[model samples]
Target: MTLPFFVYGTLRPGEPNHDAFLRGRTRTERPARLTDAVLYDGPGYPYAVPEPGGVVHGDLITALPDAYAELLHALDALEEYVPGDPRSLYERIAREVIREPDETPVRAWVYLAAPSIATALRTGGTRIQTGDWHSRNR
Candidate 1:
């Protein structure tokens, strides 16, 4: 079965990693938002953490089964997510994303910042209040 992934940072279309990882791999992509999530600057990238009144803007990408496997591998490596690894930078988890325009809700995989990392960023990193990495970075 195909799976959907919510991408908020480098993996979004026209971003640095999109061509390398998602281009020609995803079956469909549309603007989406993850509610109850705040985005914070993390050096060259951005990290997301759950927050009561936050909303993170991103894209929902659907991948075919074969492409999903390969995409997951590449994404995991890039996000430094290792299942059961204590030192992993990010944790891949399932979450609901609200599609734009119509605001339809859909479940998708999202890479969230590790708890400790999120705490660190919350304490010191610049919060992207707008939740848009491209706009915030630019």
Candidate 2:
């Protein structure tokens, strides 16, 4: 699928990996939120753990059509996501996110915490109360 991406952590603009991975590759990036998921702090990044009644704040990114395939492969590699790999750090899944302001729904690829990580996080991880990784420090 060549859908847009919903980035919530290091991949968001201004984050460390943004320029290296997303800069000119995306045609548009706007505020958006993923419902039914919560944000948690990872070693150096953040993870989105699916949870009932949860929400995560982030941006919805539209990749330039020509760059879609390359970007997809790069991102999957960056996230260490191999389809059906149990040990992967994250799993890329398609989910509906609500675009900011107008609240339009858009289907985008969201990198979520893999099963093992999600289990550990649920046991004893520090949740970002505001649901926004950028606001976690503040």
Candidate 3:
């Protein structure tokens, strides 16, 4: 089954990873938002967490193969993309992504960054930008 990846960073369209994975690839991108979220500064990446009323903007991409999944995973070096890794951040799971008026809700495997990752790379600062990976260290 193709998987859904919850991407809040540069993996979005027109970004660096977009070309590698989404370039010329036919997939559904949904406008989904996460609430009470804070983006954290990881060693070389970013992670999200639920806050009181903080909302996060992201998308849910569907119909991706294992290879494509790996390609999408290459974007984050902070977590292990292996079949089983304790230090892994995002997990491949199915979730309901918010769909726009003209959008449709499709089932997909989403990669959720682990909370421990948030604690590990918690630098206390993350900014929201369209298609740019935010890192306090950067």
Clashing pairs in 3: 3-109, 4-109, 4-110, 36-51, 36-54, 89-114, 90-112
Model 1 lDDT per residue over 10-75, tens place: 999989999989888888899999999999988789999988889999999998667888888989
What are the lDDT figures for the candidates, one per model? 0.91, 0.94, 0.54
Of the candidates numbered 1 and 3, which has the greater TM-score value? 1
lDDT (C-alpha) at residue 19 in model 2: 96
User: Per-residue alpha-carbon lDDT of model 3 for 1-138, expressed as tens digits?
Assistant: 445656665566655666665655535666665554556544455556544555556666653454575555564452354456766666555654445554555454445556665555444444443222432334
Clashing pairs in 2: none
RMSD of 1: 1.3
lDDT computed for candidate 3: 0.54
Q: Which stretches of candidate 3 lie over 4 Å from their true place?
A: 1-3, 64-79, 101-107, 121-138
Q: Against the correct fold, how does model 1 do in TM-score?
A: 0.95
Predicted structure with the largest lDDT when compared to the true one:
2
Look at candidate 2 and tell me the lDDT of residue 120.
98
Better of 1 and 2 by lDDT: 2
lDDT of 2 by residue, 73-129 (tens): 999999999999898999999999999989999999999999999999999998999
